[model samples]
Target: MPVTHATGIGPVPTAAPKLAPNVLDLFSLKGKVASVTGASSGIGKEVAIAYAQAGADVALWYNGNPKAVETAAMLEKEYGVRAKAYKCPITDSAAVEATTAQIVKDFGRLDVQVVNAGVAWEAGPMIDVEGHDEWKKVIDIDLNGAYYAAKAAGRVFKSQGTGSLIFTASMSGHIVNIPQMQACYNAAKAGLLHLSRSLAVEWAGFARSNTVSPGYMITEISNFAPKDTKQKWQQLIPLGREGNPRELVGAYLYFASDASTYTTGADLIVDGGYCAP
Candidate 1:
């Protein structure tokens, strides 16, 4: 029988260098089109701005958040990149698909999709929280919505043979938060981490998939937590401070640009050393 070269049974072909000659060139997203969900405020808003600043036209998606329209305008005016806002109900798979298709239609191509729309558990303990409905709300937006977005973006990526998919997971996904019972939220994020890893392998040939699991950040979402609770977090965090939303932009940017072409299924945690211990 002839020797098989596919499994290292014979001479192996050397891989060609794929990175740009200049290091900065690898990070440029010029001419690319990026769509980010939950872009009205917080980390999502910052991420959209960063993508535009990196030279990519941006599409902002929000669920009933009209401020995203203004944010879109600001991005275009500030970065000189074409930007628009879409009211997308990410919880609905069909709505996500339609919105993604519309973005591609308006932009003429798709390059990056950031699934950052998520909600925190507000009902306190899981035992006291209203059953089914409350849990459903978090799971739908946090986990299922991410799945929907990936499905829509994966289609475009497959066709183009290139794309970037970034999910805004959380440090809670890696370790349970203290003094707060957010079982549903934690589970959803943990699931997202695994989902991204699975999709990374599945879409290896066409695109790259990764996650940015931020720790407690100074965002509107944190406002829901009691002041005392936040202080507790600061003490637990090794860095002794919460992160800023703008601080997360660099992680997402790296994943969205050519700089991370060889990186996939990676979970970059930016939680002010919360998980370091």
Candidate 2:
């Protein structure tokens, strides 16, 4: 039988003073299984390696880059962790679901999932974006792709009673970038920011959802911009330079491990003070 309350209001309870016995251990991902999309190169690749270094078996997903196969082997050899690569298109909802299920099957369980697959906006501003194909392609991969990944992993998380979902948003989500007109990219990222927050509430008590918004990084993705444009970005950044992919490992690792057990609906901006001023 259910206990009945004498009054509609209940007394407020005092907050518990709980802390980890070993704070450093909180950052360890030992024995956990993680998956990262867009692991073929750039930030995703670095994040995959970092998770393995932290002792988590990882599944790296790449859309077209065959290099991830070798990278997966490298991760296993270097970190002594289980790592594999899957060729799947994030834009395909069914494919994302199938890939995620395979990872859980192969690894026994899924602990962390990083939905980092994305594409750059090749068109100009929204006015000059030309066709709907341009915008559709961006949204399909960046926004919709994230949604599909979350939906697939959320099921596993709910079943396990605990999990972590991390998305690679961008500082562009927070601010309109200069020297380049990527309205579609910014909009998709901004949508992702809110998507993560919404999932956090919806999945509360079962899993945590968060995003890592990186600033201008010195990755191959930025190779398209000219030297003068790159120099302009350096001047705008308070740190006087673009960030390295390695610098973002800590943020991803924290969100992927026990260190952020109580952290959710949060957006960690790893932009070298770009959004500060």
Candidate 3:
């Protein structure tokens, strides 16, 4: 028998070595379910898709988007996941409670709840802000709506023993913007962040909670800014551009899934270094 030093090892097995448990796998959301408020369009729509792609069944609620049915269909078809759309307005506590019940009935369970439905006023100073009715409308829709959604989700999560509550806050919560003013919107988002952190602490034992503070993300809402204004904003950011709404997916995913098992009460900022300086 000629033994060659270059001969392959004799102990080769028929199978590949098992991979070490991945944090990524731990982060997976397969078989879990999520409910996304304001999912008719914008970031909410994108988050719904992202959740589906992550192996979750999704329930999307919209206040007024007739197209939401199509969005629901798309999620189901694309991700091979169960998807549904509801017409729920977050400003109505009773409505939220009812809608949440419907979601649970349809989805079988809710593991993640994202409170992303919010409204903003046209950019301008406070005094020049159209009229009293407008100011109240913005606050009611933005601030109070978040409270209702969080409360409704909190109730279900408490009953279930484990869940994640996420809020869609903004960088405006930390720093006020220029050229255009959104005082009411700023205040509302600031309230949302604090509320999330407080809830995280209060719900520490059974559920996890967090918020995503996106900075100048490019979206239909951002189109209100003029070309020059947007250009100026880019210069302010160290990364030289505004973040896209899709960029917000990772933060929410971490909070909504098992990946952030040890994380809570955290504000994951996706501001493209705009707040760095």
Candidate maximizing TM-score: 1
Candidate 1, residues 190-228: lDDT per residue as tens digits? 999999999987887678899999999998877888889
Preferred candidate (lDDT higher): 2 or 3 = 2
- Please give the clash total of every predicted structure, in order: 0, 0, 0
Clashing pairs in 3: none
lDDT of 3 at 73: 95
* Candidate 3 residue runs with Cα over 4 Å from true position: 1-20
TM-scores for every predicted model: 0.94, 0.93, 0.90
lDDT by residue for model 2 over 127-200, one digit each (tens)? 97566998999999999999999999999998997789999999999999988899999999999999999898
Pairs clashing within candidate 1 = none
lDDT of each: 0.91, 0.91, 0.84
Q: What is the lDDT of residue 157 in candidate 3?
A: 86
Per-residue lDDT of model 3, residues 1-277, tens digit only: 1122356543222222243278787667898999999888888988998999999999998977867789989988888999999998787889999999889998888899999987766747899755687778878887898899888888888888778999999888999887678898899889999998888777765677899998888787787788998998888889999887899898888888777777878998899987677
* Greater-TM-score candidate between 1 and 3: 1
Could you give the candidate ranking by TM-score, starting with the highest? 1, 2, 3
As a TM-score, model 1 comes out at 0.94
The superposed Cα distance between candidate 3 and the true structure at residue 76, in angstroms, equals 1.2
